[model samples]
Target: MLEQVANGKLTKWLAPSMRVGWSMVETVLLTAAAVGIGLWLRPEDPMTLDADFRWILLVPLVIAMRYGGLVGVWAMLCLIGCWYVLKTSGLYAQQSFPEGAMLGGLVFTLVAGEFSDLWRVRLMRADSAASYSLERLKNLTQRFVLLRLSHDRLEENLLTKPYTVRDALFRLRSLALEESSDTALPAGDDLLGILAEYCQLQRAALYPCRDGVIDDRPVAVLGENRPLEKDNSLLAYAMENQLLAHVQQEKEESYHGAYLVAAPISNSAGKIIGVLVVERMPFLSVNFENLQLLSVLLNFYADVVYAGKDTHLLLERWSALPFQMARELVALGRLREEGKVETSLTLFVADDSEQAGLILDALARGLRSLDLAWWVSDRTLLIMMPMTGVSGLEGYVLRTEQWLQDEFAFMSLRQAGVRFFYRHMDTRSTEVQLAELLEAGGV
Candidate 1:
């Protein structure tokens, strides 16, 4: 499956070169065919200028429509070359060139090319936005599943387990921050221990993956487990789909696998950095709820593993802020630096603390799944929006204003004693910008 993915990527990488080559070939052949037809009709004027309509201009127009302006210009040059060929070969021809006709054709081709280019860019941007949205949706779906499962389990095991899932995650974050080892999976044994307690895995192993390839050796193992197999079906399925796969998922296919469950551990950017394979677990524990918890826990651990050193420093500086928010802020900043996407941070502040608190509660209730909100103080609130640009921020602000008017009967934000400030993530250091924003909001 990995090999197939790699091949598909390679094909996509070479598609542009193949497209250009094919376009060149088509331009040459079509130009030749058009010249042949023109010569058959009027050998004296192969360009067919003697006719009321210039039929030869269609070649460049077609090429322009198909391959854009550059290739269309190439087709026009080929026509010029054909004309010169006729003139030099002593075929009957006019003394002067048809400059007006050629100029008109060039202008028409360029106009068509410009339209194509414009639509191409629009389509590319739309596709990129869709892909980012899809990834966000997938992440949110996993979180929702985990939430539902956690709630159900809490009802059953509230007395048995002293700490909630959130507490376990906080401990995981602490482990990530404090680990000094250079291995890819920091506090591997502790992570597995948490999973064992939560997922009821009697025997499992966590194997580190580098560059999409899983290592044969296990970084962390619980109880007695077989060594990692090179051709494990569950591992292949999990890596292929970037999700959790278990024996019950496809009984006919996965029943033959040596492990009961396999899951990929992916970072916030959705890159798999590790794999967890369970060799032994109770039959009742192989259900969807338990598997979902396992996947979520692995993903949570992966996020902590991927958080850079900058995130740790930010956490140390602002102990009140959540680790997840700090990690996302740094990730968005890196994305902005790479010119892949933009993020926005909005601060809502009010002179009246009571009004601000009310507004903050309302905003909290209306927050999107992808947004992270922090109640910075009694008089201030901060929201971080991922993959949002200036235009998106404007729309968000407008919507919030309308909601305020409808919910609180306030004429405007100013009337409600509220003011908003926004900043788009830029090339500056994320930690520095965050500190500045927080200080400006008087946090």
Candidate 2:
């Protein structure tokens, strides 16, 4: 608040009236000094130097260039006024060709002031255009840099094959769409199909595992329904090391003779969640390209699994999800205890349910990507913003209020019953409260 107050004072000092007043005062004082010097240097007879005071005219010219035409004109007028009073008081002798000498000084003042004003106007226009262009260039450069970085990240993560065809691009797009559309983790059938289509593997088996333990039979298989034996060392080695293992013909165990490749499906945290086994060909047939593609696809699959979604509606409204609220709070509490991140929650209440959707749409435009908004009730919205505190939440509320006013100038949204409340959740303390809310309904 103190800083803001100081800034306000600085702004007021820079206003036009303050600047012009100071400039005019300086001009007036200097012009009076020039007139006094002329009087001091005056001869007993002014006819000795008919235009002796002509040199003093430079003072007004200099002031005109420094403070602009208006100040310059006033300074010139004051100089002329002082000369008229001196001549009337009979302190300085009258000059011959007085009209011609005075006319020259008057013309000089008008010309200097006019040129000064012209230059000032031109300079202002040039500065404005330069500033506008520089701002546009800066914005474009930032957007371009962000676009390039996003493209580079996609390339590094996906590692598209060299000389990739249009078909490969289409396949990648299809996978992205499927990954976004499906709420749950990719099923075993989906993995098997990707292996066959992209990795050129015709035989494979998917074994489901939970927390690094394979507790169930094969969930999916291709080309054969035979389940992997429990004693298979190849499968055990892949799961134990959390890596892809290739069986050599000379070193292959008798029980695993038919299988050539075994890979583990790990989650984002590097936990072994499932195991994949394929035996369509020998180890030499599986190139590094195939392995890389497989790894990329599995990593994407792991992300979808970790996202914790069930249905499309739940995914769309994941912020205020009743089922996930307790889990999210638990994770937030752990992070806070570990001194990792900050979190804040904001609630927007609408007195009129009919305008809730409109308010939500406008609010979304003002929120960051990490911020999530969901409707907990018909007239209430809960927004969870990661890495934000109470002060940041206040700024967000003010920005949203301003945006609503700008977008809906015809209607007063704030006066129509939209209200917002925010609190910085002490994640450690709010965990139990969040759990209770989840058990009842979303907060």
Candidate 3:
């Protein structure tokens, strides 16, 4: 068995490397065969120089089409080596090199190689896009399933439960915000309790994790607490894949272990900072919808934890700023600092006039779903567009102007008594920039 495994591993490793090896081998063998045919047809000029066509050029052309530019160049070098061998061996006494023929062959080989490379790059890009889309589809499918389940539960318990999930989430957010800084997880027990109520858990534990290591001690427990197993298969799988794993999953059948559910608590940036391990739950709750809901709730809590540190201060300073906008601003600031993404902030201030208010209202309604908008005042609106660069901001302004022209017959925003200010999120402090923007807008 060990021998078989070793061979399997070796095969996997060599599979990708073998393509280049085969290309080299084919280049050598085919070059030799072409030279052999030339020698057989014309012993004096083995390269078939006197022929109407230098057939040896086909070798590099074929290799270029099969492999790429570098390997094709190697094939041309092989042909040159064969020519040197013939000349040095006294079989051919040609002093002048066939530079013209060689150059033309190289040009054709490069053209073919370039064509191959272009398509290869396009194929790779297409595959990457498809993979990203598929991942998004999977996430949306899970959320949809959870939403349907939550809707059904809401209808069934409309009388008993006076609040919807949205209200519960808002309350949870408030609870998380009110948590003291000393604790690793803000409102840990409350979070677990809420999860138990929704996910129907009898026994579960929330374990704080850092840098992919799960702590043995539970931050919160629903029932009798138990030590986390260091080598739990479900935990390992969930952590490795950054996904929720449960007994019902097809891949978990072989090694379900002592836990019924294992889910990673990932922040907005998809970093796992904690793990949720459920030991006892209703058998029916082990299904997909409940598990998905559990995962979603954990993710929501994780996002709150991730953004709470920065947003807390912002919220304290700006009482009127929406919590969601504050969170997104903090996230965008971090992203800008890391040089991972760029975001734009557009502020629209309207004069205290009826027409300006109408234009501002129209602009508010026209904002994209990805954009976060906040009305700093009755006539002042702040919009944050994520992943939009300076050029995107310019385009957005032009589009908005054009839209105003068509919709309200206004030639320009200024003509409509609307003033706009734009700023790109840079490495500077977000709070300082936000203050500067608010001050500029006379807030």
Q: Tens digit of lDDT per residue, candidate 2, span 39-103?
A: 56754432223554557778777776665667778876777676666677775544433566556
> RMSD to the native, candidate 1?
19.2
Top candidate on lDDT is 3
Which ranges in model 1 have alpha carbons more than 4 Å from their true place? 1-164, 176-182, 251-254, 308-324, 328-443
Assess candidate 2 and give its lDDT. 0.60
What lDDT does each candidate get? Answer: 0.77, 0.60, 0.78
lDDT of 3 by residue, 1-443 (tens): 67856656653432222278887988899999999998898887778766789888988987876677778899999999998899888876656788998899999999987886676677579969989999999999999999999999877554333444444444555563542335667678999988877778889999988788888888899998578986988788888898888876636447747788888987655677789888998776676556655765676677556665567788899989988788768766765675655788888899988999998888888876467789998999999887689888889988988988888898899899998787899888788889888888777
Ranking by TM-score: 3, 1, 2
lDDT of 1 by residue, 43-92 (tens): 78778866788889999987886677888898898888887888788773
> Poorest 10 consecutive residues of model 1 by lDDT?
9-18
Candidate 2, superposed: residue stretches over 4 Å from native: 1-18, 39-49, 88-90, 93-99, 160-215, 219-443
